[model samples]
Each structure stands twice: as structure tokens, then as C-alpha cells.
Target: MSEIVFRSRFDNGRRKAFERSPKVSLTSPDFYFSHCFGVCRKKTSMGPPGIIWVASRVTQPDKLSEERFCEWYEGQHIDEVTALSGVPAAARYEAVPMSELAGPPTAETIKAAEQRPDYLMGGKWLTIYEMKDVDFRHTAEFKSLDGQSKPKGNLLDEIFTKAHFETRFGALLSNDDKGIKKGPGKLIISATMTPGSRASAEDIEQFYEREHVAEIAKCPGYVRTRRFRWVDTTVLKEFERLPADPIEPGNSVVALHEFEGPYFPMEGLLKADETPWTARVLESLKKNGIEAGFYRLKRVYGEWLPGSSKL
Candidate 1:
């Protein structure tokens, strides 16, 4: 199993509330959550929250009106898609006011329809987030795809979706964006490579050097990437009672890269039809013989509001 921490880079007030009093019951209304990692039986540190909820009206790029897009999105119920993908934690959806949304949202201009009383009352942008958990990475499942079950989607598709997710609410974290906590916009992207052929310690070291990992700093949004030697135990028990059910302990090297600044700016480029640049970066890694799947993460938090139930 793998675990990660997720957080938002916007709203210092909310982030403070989450950290100061973090923990929410699964039954809470304002705190809807979900996780790709597995079941979250208990809570952990409530670090802080971020604006990560994202939905795109232009999946195919027909350029529909904001009203038409909203209607279409509601009809599709993409939330159900998120839930069905084996969410390990509970998550909720929030509609942020246009003023609160990170980026400039076109949705704000649409007036509420005559019958939609509830629609006009809230903000134009929406936010969805998962509940807090300490051991999120440990619950995620990473399976090998056989030649038969290879992924059907192209790399551009995957990166675009993620970029959109990270960037949609990223505007709030911008240097000029107000109410951002000092450390609000920090983020990490982790990559776990399942070697096509088992690699030795020397091989790993050589790969990193050969792949020019030292040059990651050259990238525009590049922060820092660290390589882990793969700790076999998920938890340490008194240095005597070893953890019983740890995830795969062999043949994997974990690389963690930290990104500071905005949520994910890569999506903006992708959305604007800049696949070549994105592809070039990805291809560069492949050229260096480095193959790994990248997963981005943030920290979610729960601020125990007065009258909020605890589990």
C-alpha cells in the first residue's frame, strides 16, 4: 500500500481552522470526502485543506455556455464516478463563491433559473475534498497491467485531467492571491516505478544520475525530487514487533518531488492544447530510460466546528 498527504494552498482562515481543530465524523454534512487509497478506519493529523475539486465542461471541447455546462455536469453526476473508483475516504462537494474561486470563473455570470432557488444563493465555483487521514498512502492499490490490460487512455489525457485538478483552485494560492497561508501552496508529486527488470542499488543510483534528475531544477515549476530506498515496514512497533501486513517490499523505488507555487500549472498549458511541450517533458524522461508513474498529492483537514460530531 501507498499513502500521501493532500492540502490546499488557498484560504488561510479555513486552513487554520482545520489545523487548530482537525477531525470530523464520517456523518458530517459540510465535510464530504473520498480517497483513492483504501478505507480510512481512523483519523490522523488535520494539516490543512486546499481547493482541489475540479470539473471541466469541455471534456470534448464543444464550447457550451456556462448554463448549459452546469446543467450537463449535474446530469452526469461525476461525483458518482469518483465514488465508484474505490474511494478509500469520504469526501464532500462545496460551491465556492465566484470571489472565492481561485481562478477567474465564467460560471459566475450565469443567473439562476426561475425554478432554481438554491442555485443563486451560493458561489459560482465548486470545491470537493477528501477527509483527513494519516495513513492515506498505505491504502492505495497499485497493480501491474499485463500486456492485455494496458491503459487505454493516452498520457496527454491523464496529465490534462490532473493538471486541471491542481490548477482549477490553484489561483487562490498565487503569490498575489489574498488569504493564502504562508505555506499554503506547497505540494508533492510521488512516482513509484515498477522496474520492467529488477534494478539493483547500483542500478538505481546510475539511473538517477543517468536520467539527469539533478537537472529537475531546470524545469519551470520544478521544486525538489527525493528518492527513497524503499522502507519495507509501514510502521515500526517498539523495534521488536514488526508490522505484519506491509505492502510490496521489493523491486520498487519511490521518488518524491515537491512543487511550490500554484496547484498545478501544467493543466493550463494542456487545456490550451499545448500537448507537445508536455509530451516533450515526458518523452525526455523516457529517453533517459526512466519509467515511472507519477502521482500528485495534497493534504486534507477537518476543523471540528462547534456542534460537529466526532468519531
Candidate 2:
């Protein structure tokens, strides 16, 4: 029998190893997607090429002050990070205060956002960057041509000191919004968790790919769901040349949902569904481990500019 093979629609009859995540083509049959009966999807889409996610959270140090920090970040920091060859785009988000978050909130999620532990990256602030298929570790700006440490010069000086910050990098596993618009929407649901020690990561990924995501689509105005695994820093000798001590990644996978209009992302999540599927899913995540939150999106720059009252 002739061998049956699977490959992307973009494949030129050659199978190249995917660098981080598999390259899914536009015409693949098993595309990740869903539909909300009431919310119609716009006829626009902006997707990443083998998207790698880089998320960092931070806090304002005692002396730097919020105003100075904003001026510095808005004036320069955002540009520097986005300019890196691999990075396609960058955006900053301020965690909505626990009181303002939607539906019934999870206490642990609220606490984690407030505490901003080393593992959680930073307190109150999250900077998300979308990286293309390129390996950031090998970039000229990140490392020397001969494989040596390369300083970001004064840009490095401006960061790390002004606030407490850390990050986690990973590839796109599955996204309901794979072909959806990459707009700066008004709300986001960011949930992070590690799988049970006994269960392989693939098992968790497959479960979501097959079930949970579709169930969550029932939530009103749901736009998309993007899942990510912690980038294993040790893979490419990248950690050796880096400055920050990448804390051990605990919450290995993060599921982010984007929503717009008047609906809340957690309206469905916070309420326990009395079904075998969702109940088991939640039970499994808990026994395995989970940390999550509902955040109202706060845009930091551009046309959505704010006065001194904003962050």
C-alpha cells in the first residue's frame, strides 16, 4: 500500500520540520474554529505564521512612579520590543481591578493578578508580543552572530529596573480565532494552568482541541480561544545568553479568549455547567492545576489614548 502522509497545503511536496508549532495551511480540513449564534463574525482576519507568544507581567517599582513609567514605555519601550525581527506586534494591557472584572470571578485569579508573583510575570501589567515563525533567540538583536550575549544597550537599561517583570514564551497550539481579526478588543480571558503530572501535555491539548473550546463558544459574543504551552527555554541554548532568569514555568498552558461588545468572557466559565464534560474538565484542570482570570482590556497606546487618569 502507498504511504498516507499529512502535510500543510503550503507544502511544496517537501516536509520541513515545524520549528515551534506545526504550520497549518489555509485549506486544511481540521481547522480550529467555532460560531456564536447571536454574534456574527466580521469578514476580516489577521493570523500569525506559526505564532509564538511572549507574555510578561510587571509592577511599578517604588521610585520609578507610574507617570514616568508610562512616558518611558509609550515613548520607547514598546518600539524596541516590537522592532525585534521575530516579533510581528506588541501590546500592553493593564489588569482590570478585581472589583471591575465580569460575571462571577474566581478568587485565585484575582489574587494572582494582584500579587504578580515571579511565575505570573508581573503585577497589574501584561505585555503580549506575537512572534512569527522566526526563533527569537537567534535574532541579531537578541544574540551575537558568533553566538555570544548581545546587549540591547540603553534600551535594556530602561527596562527590568523601572519595574518587576518576567515572561513566558510559547507557540500557538489551537485558536478558534486562527482566521479572525487581530483587533485590540475590549475584553480578554487569560487562564493558565499545568496538566496533571500523570497526564501528558498532548492529552490536555487534544482534550481542548476535541471538546472544551467548542463548549465555551456558547458564551455570548465569544470571539476566539488561543492555547499556548510554555516555551521550553532550554531547547536552543537560548537561556544561556539571556539576562532574565526564566523562572521555572509552572502554568505550562494558557488559554486566552477574546470577546467584544457587551458580553463578558467569564459569564459562562464562572458558572459551573452541570454536565459530565465541563465538570470533568474543570475537575481535571484542578487536580492537574490551574490559575486563571477575567480581564477587561485596557489599551495602552495609539488612537485609544487616555489622560492622566489612565495607565
Candidate 1 versus the native: TM-score?
0.27
lDDT of each: 0.30, 0.45
Candidate 2 C-alpha lDDT tens digits along 1-311: 00000101122122132233465542342221100011122424433233233333323355456666656554665555555555546556666655345544577666755654333322455555565542343333533211122223542344433444334555566657632344545677677666554464556676677777877777667667777665432211111113223222433777777776544645576552445655555566544256555555554333221110111
List model 1 lDDT by residue over 7-78, tens digit each: 112234644555576565423423322211122344455422222233222232333344544443343323
Q: Each candidate's TM vs. the true structure?
A: 0.27, 0.60
lDDT of 2 at 12: 19
Worst 10 residues of 1 by lDDT: 166-175
True-structure lDDT of candidate 1: 0.30
The numbered model that scores best in TM-score is 2
